[model samples]
Target: MPENRTEISELGEFGLIERLNQDVILRNPSTLKGIGDDAAVIEAGDHVKVVTTDLLIEGVHFDLSYAPLTHVGFKAVAVNVSDIAAMNAIPTQITVSIALSNRFSVEAVEDLYAGINAACEHYGVDLVGGDTTASRGGLVISVTAIGEAQKDQVSYRSGAKVNDILCVTGDLGSALIGLQILEREKQVYLANPDMKPDLEKYDVVTGRQLKPDARMDIIHELREMDIVPTSMMDVSDGLASEIFHICKASNVGALIYEDKLPIDKQTFDTAVELNLDPITCVLNGGEDYELLFTIDQKDFAKLEKHPDIHFIGHMTKAEEGKFLVTKSGTAVQLKAQGWKHF
Candidate 1:
């Protein structure tokens, strides 16, 4: 008889997280939130601190063949900041740790830091401290961001209620489409060294992939408007997958309108050029780094006039089940087929 063994693939990413978090206990009263939400909340004197961290492995999260080191550095910071934004907090500091192989030179590291510093300036965060180590495999970057918000203003994934309006910021699917384009062009170049990548027309999608701007602007705007979302999270995963997370956390279902999904014209056209369904890309594509949140029904009118925010759906009773109302008025079950590392 073989010794008992379980594969990580048996439990998907979320399932693995749940299983691993099952026995974990919060020992301190200051730990307001633990492993479930985007970031863990720690009680401070007057306000609360939201802390989140993200680890990016070279080939797994980014490909150096097409991805610039500068963009990678910036993206590493942005992703962590996006998690802080998900908690409805303003990021103040970040610590970036990197593991480097001899393949990189001092100039290369400087270029990477240039982007990291640019992101810190862009987001108004200070690079307090981090660790540097040697890597046997490839470059690895881990960023931990700390943000602040009043206890009353912090939003959690569990705060959404039935009938709350579901909102998403900016466009979706562009990053995925951009990634596809980069991979396609890389393949072309690998096949023939003489071929120069024609990436000018694909700027929007590629930019979304190379460097994603976290939705900190929306957080600031919401603060200005005095609107704290009932529930929120950044769309690091695909739209459908993220909706599933919100639903599971809030114990509610969602019914988003297909017509209401935001897809940029360039992304739509390029997806068709690649023989991909635009809507499916919007729903299942990941790495957009946009914000998906729910506002109380009464708060809907305030954000309605805002240009970037899109009202795509409303929360429903969990028993109602999650579905997407197609353009033809047919409700279809949503599948979480987004990015799967395993």
Candidate 2:
């Protein structure tokens, strides 16, 4: 009585997107892009409009038990804004939709909106409009962000050229380390409800996990400096995974240096405490939300002195192969073990 049913896990998220993209037919001339890139591009007069969407489910994308609704709201907006920035566009508006069950009170919803409103103000984006509905399950939030930029200002994953300087913003691995600490504390709390979590010392790592700020500041700085990244993407997955994406998209290879990888002191310390290799955490950790971009070799001098940005390596010819040059002067092939829900 049952038909053949394939589990979504079998195909994976990217696989599903690839399959769906095959059936998509772009009809409108104004529609410059569909799926595949960080955001969809649309021709709009002198500039192009970039649109991106993300859906967050309670249990799958987040654990409501540990994740505060306020932080959840901020993260939801920051993630969407990150995509817009990846396209080298300035976010102008966002529409947020939420489906709630009776378990959440109106006051709780207000707390969530407080974060959303704060993010909107921080990013200078208007909360245009969205829909709300009753859900039998836990909270579900969907956000769509719209941004704009000049035709020439847009950066895509496919724009990296051989010999371009690979750059990363801020640090990596903090968020993943923070998650581990939170989970550990949560387990402790569950075992004995009276124990208060000593979270004061881990504020930096915890903040990275909760209220991640999108690097629109860097985007604005690039504009001010008159520099456009040859290629760009946000580090949602991990450094290694994101580098692989840029390489695959631009038909190039990369050679990163282990010593050049950026890991915060708190992240390194916490990772050591949790028995995770700090470098491994930097390479494979997820949700750092930093910008990973490539710049022309000539433009490197301009950004060389930037305190927050790190110059890890250079883009290489596809046949050169992706490699990580260790601190001891040994080279090893790079592997991407990004976050996988399935």
Candidate 3:
């Protein structure tokens, strides 16, 4: 007899999410947004509340052998915060839940909390509440972030219009390069137990991986400049993947220039050293935690002087199709190869 079963890999992470979200029905009128975007939008009295959650599991999302518990705890909080930022909302509170195995001791848990508390303080968000549970496997952390924004200020992924300029904050691909360095060091350490990892030379890339900050600064600055993005999402799932999400949600096409993709000097050098394609990493590597958004052409001048923001592309009519114009002047179809967990 032949058995029929489908693998999760066949569906992919985003595909699985799309499949699972099909059954989710919003009964409340206040649920302005649901599973599709970075955060669920709920209508409040004078503002909209953006709620986002993330789950981090050992050996999957992170490896305990290389990642410190404190850094893991901070990352757990930051990733959710990044989602809130993607919605162009200011985070106010967070609930952090953790599942721990017997392998972790009380002090270890406290070390984890030290990082969590530090992140809460840094982000100026209150750690309101959470739940604790015992796990048979390894450490697991789930963070739910609640943020508030004026109804008109919240940027949705579906709001991009044709001709809006696409902008991304900071640089891309550094975090992936960092991860590569970490993995390389791990292999070296495993092969030679007495050899210490030469992490000092690769601090920039490694630090990008170990500790990432969400782009809350950009959101605040945009608010100050009276600039609102037409559409926005965090670059947590690679830049190309995020561009595709905005394109799909907004019913638009994108044309990005290869020469304009922002990559840090260290990130580029390290990627080359690792024998990885720098542009590919920039396009497909995940977890940079930078903001990707589209702004009205009229609002471009207001942000023209910003140091870190890079305008790599612009939205086009949907029929034009998404493309990347290479430095060689060839237009290639863009592909989304985001973080594939399945």
Per-candidate TM equals 0.98, 0.98, 0.98
Location of the lowest summed lDDT over 10 successive residues in candidate 3? 1-10
TM-score of 1: 0.98
Best candidate (score: lDDT): 1
Query: What is the C-alpha local distance difference test score of each model?
Result: 0.96, 0.93, 0.93
- State how far residue 266 of model 2 sits from its true place (Å): 0.5
> Where in model 2 is the C-alpha error above 4 Å?
1-4
Model 1 stretches astray by more than 4 angstroms: none
Ranking by TM-score: 1, 3, 2
Error of 3 at 179 (Å): 0.5
Tell me the tens digit of each residue's lDDT in model 2 across 1-342: 569988888998777878888988989999987777889999999999999999999987777778888889988999999999999999999999999999999999998899899899999999999999899999999999999999899999999999999999999999999888888899999999999999998999989988899999999999998999999999998999999999999999999999999999988998998999999999999999999999998898899999999999999999998999999999999998898878
Task: Please tell me which predicted candidate would have the highest TM-score against the true structure.
Answer: 1
Error of 3 at 201 (Å): 1.4
lDDT of 1 at 307: 94
Please list all clashing residue pairs in model 2, or write none if there are none: none
Kindly list the per-residue Cα lDDT of model 3 for residues 1-342, writing each as its tens digit: 549888888988877878998998889999999888999999999889999999999988888888888888888889999999999999999999999989999999998999899889888899999999999998889999999999999999999999999999999999999999999999999999899998998888887888899989999999999998999999998999999999999999999999999999999999999999999999998999999999999999999989999999999999999999999999999999898877
Better of 1 and 3 by lDDT: 1
